[model samples]
Target: MHPASAWLANESAHIEDEADEHDLHAFQAIRRMDEILVNNFMVFQDVVEEGCYDLVVGDEAWDVDYFLHENPELKRFAFAWMTDFVGWVPMPDGGEHEVALTADYNAEMIEQRARYGRVRDRSIFVGSPEDVVDLPFGPGLPGIREWTEANFDFAGYVTGFVPPTQQEREQVRRRLGYGEDDLLCVVTVGGSGVGGPLLHRVLDAVPAARRLVPGLRFLVVTGPRIDPAGLPRRRGVSYRGYLPELYRQLAACDLAVVQGGLTTCMELAAADRPFLYVPLRHHFEQNVHVRHRLERYGAGRCVDYEEACDPDALAVAMAKELHREEHAIPVETDGAQRAGEMLAELI
Candidate 1:
């Protein structure tokens, strides 16, 4: 069980990621997603309505109704997009059932297939172009405009996440002690109520990893809920406390190691960097989505956490990937810009 499970009753929470030492899962991702919606929507409810924002995007349910209710014109323009899966929905009225997506996983289009058979569903939710962007990573958000051009009038936007500013990057960079030559290996060490076992596995093999790259350097960032002391110390590895200098670091790094978190993955894709993803154990859905990109799409490799325990095994995997002659993953350079355009068009 996740530590935050105890705090589930409370409207607010700050749970620690104790999965590795204690029996807890890191529910921080969901919590953060919820927090973002509640806080952002609450603060800008009036602005959103007055400005006539076209769409509001989010990953969880919090102030979704407030956003919808506040804007009368937006009732038709607004959409609730789920970036994860389209399989199910948990209604506020106590019901559950299979649901269909509005778009294909990678298609830049939206089409409704069906409704929740028995659930008393409210609020329009879709994982298709009409609602959510199908790409697992956020870099695909820009494509929503293309879909909007054909489907609906996409106006200004509301999203659960935001891009970092240049000033934020410099501050994070200084704190992480990043040098020009050092390769910043940004990672989301704990996720969705789980400590990243793959991270620990990779850190344990850092010495061997260094041997593989000879001069590889890294800046591994873990969530604040995780203790810095718990992470293994190494000559080339530096642990950072939050997702600082995230964009700059991602852009600076030659490669990345991460969980299949959509937020982190999208940022990396936006940075146009190759990545090595290790989906959390038991997260079958996440594993499938990440594997689809890493293996099927040839973006990167999805190595099992267990295999990372052995230095030689990890070294070999690293060697194989680092040595690959294929070009790095191609990320759209104008995702944010395109997203902005979509927002402009919608408004």
Candidate 2:
């Protein structure tokens, strides 16, 4: 069972139970293994024991060092990212640190991630594009290792990656009601509920955008965190609530209008889709980590959505990006295999 299974069951048993049942075969097969690694979740920190697994791999979170120190029997590693609450991300043992640099990669942010990683002890530093880690560790995010190398001062090296297959892209496109002659644009919230209301300001332009550009259709993907109902909608707008198939949906689109989440940006880049991204205002990750890197990648530019919410401005923005080139820097897409190997060497 996943670390969060019990809690999900308690909070929403129908969804939770269905999930368990769907993955029951895999769960039974895993139990037959000699060892297993469950994803690290902050909510389960206390409940999970030191001996819960042989290794624990996680993204930036609180008290990582404390958890490892308390459980000396376990091996742990962290992939660093830009966030408001980075705290101290320390990898157990004599391991080096890997940073998945975001769009706004710079001298300051490099030092920031390095500073956080080296709080308790000095360690080797390796950098990959943001896609590698959330555009995440491996093909979970493609083109990240390359993104980091091009813009940042650090060496780009991450061991895992996964790119979507053509078949997968077709499936997602069909699922999103993509038409042969339609210009598909994907709008996303990046799994954070924080900027839902603000995003509507951008979506409000879609009606006019459609009027300006023929054969254009919009898919407003609110992500898992935001409720689609709360967002503004109309008869023709494609408001997809939460489609877990990220790379495919992105690949199917002609352009993307998105929030400043590293994974969303990287996926759009990997899929060769142009977008006008809006990093959340006053957010370190969006404002600093993602804002500055837009021109660097040619994927899209950042918009101060609040100030740029006039539907005309939004329509022009979308029209301008329709012909924009994506992938300012070429991204190497061989992360999944590399990540698996890297994790194997960690212990």
Candidate 3:
């Protein structure tokens, strides 16, 4: 990782623990964003000048968009995997937190637009049109343009890798030392330590789950932020830290229990795997945006974190969902190609 990224990561490592303080974190991050950008602006400008790039592409990099807004000489293409730009996240507690963050974002965008100009020439929504709708606050606002229903024709969810074929699935299973009759359950909580509580709850349900279904094995994937050593060992349960190309492993599993992150849920949906997703409490993006899109695709069982806390209930849920029929709507896999063509037009 770059020095700046490492510094930022170290600074924000505790944010996940204080879920209710998300708004405060957002405000502070936004306040610091300009300072960070200003510090690196000259270096970035020097690099861009030397490169003479026809178009600058950014993935949820608002700072890049702001820079492009100031320097309209180069075309800008911005894409986002989430609906953060829409600024209409419905939080569990209410809209106060959402409103505060949205106001901050809007203020920044409006100020930049007045001082410079529109931040982007065109933007791509890496999701279905249903994911982007006019909420009470409205659609993409304040200097964000060319992103509406029309973008959906070319925009699609990019899963980064194709789902494995049946033969390949078997290859992965055999490589993992699983027999044909052994039922494999892969549990993950994305990259953040916020899911640590969820992982522990799932572990608590393991004994009951194995009793409900014998021959069932659990593979708890503690992502980069969580240490596998922290979780207690149990029979029929194994712990591993951060498997690369984890989507392939997900494809080969009989069932998956995951946190409500778009990328992980979408990967399981794309692989046609049975899964139960527990969205974090008070998380607007996961509870609102990701849930809407997942429901649209008829993918994954939405389990509340409170409900998942009950080991018996979670165990029963896990047993019921294991080896169930795959009925999720197919996810588009050509998004990268489509996005590439869209950018090619700008060039």
Pick the TM-score winner.
3
Model 3 CA lDDT for position 9: 28
Taken over the whole model, the C-alpha lDDT of each candidate is 0.49, 0.52, 0.72
lDDT of 2 at 195: 49
TM-score of 3: 0.81
Q: Which stretches of candidate 2 lie over 4 Å from their true place?
A: 3-52, 66-171, 292-295
Instruction: Give the range of the ten consecutive residues with the poorest summed lDDT in model 3.
Output: 76-85
Model 3 deviation from the true structure expressed as Cα RMSD, one decimal place: 4.3
Model 1: residues with Cα > 4 Å off, grouped in runs = 1-85, 88-186, 190-193, 294-297, 341-347
User: TM-score of the candidate numbered 1?
Assistant: 0.56
Report the Cα lDDT for residue 138, model 1: 23
> What TM-score against the true fold does each predicted structure earn?
0.56, 0.63, 0.81
Better structure of 1 and 2 per TM-score: 2
Q: Provide backbone clash counts, one per model.
A: 11, 21, 0
The Cα error of candidate 1 at residue 245, in Å, is 3.2
lDDT of 1 by residue, 5-82 (tens): 332333323333223421222232332445545665545454554566556554354355434433334444444433
Best candidate per lDDT, number?
A: 3
Model 1 sits at a Cα RMSD from the real structure of: 9.8
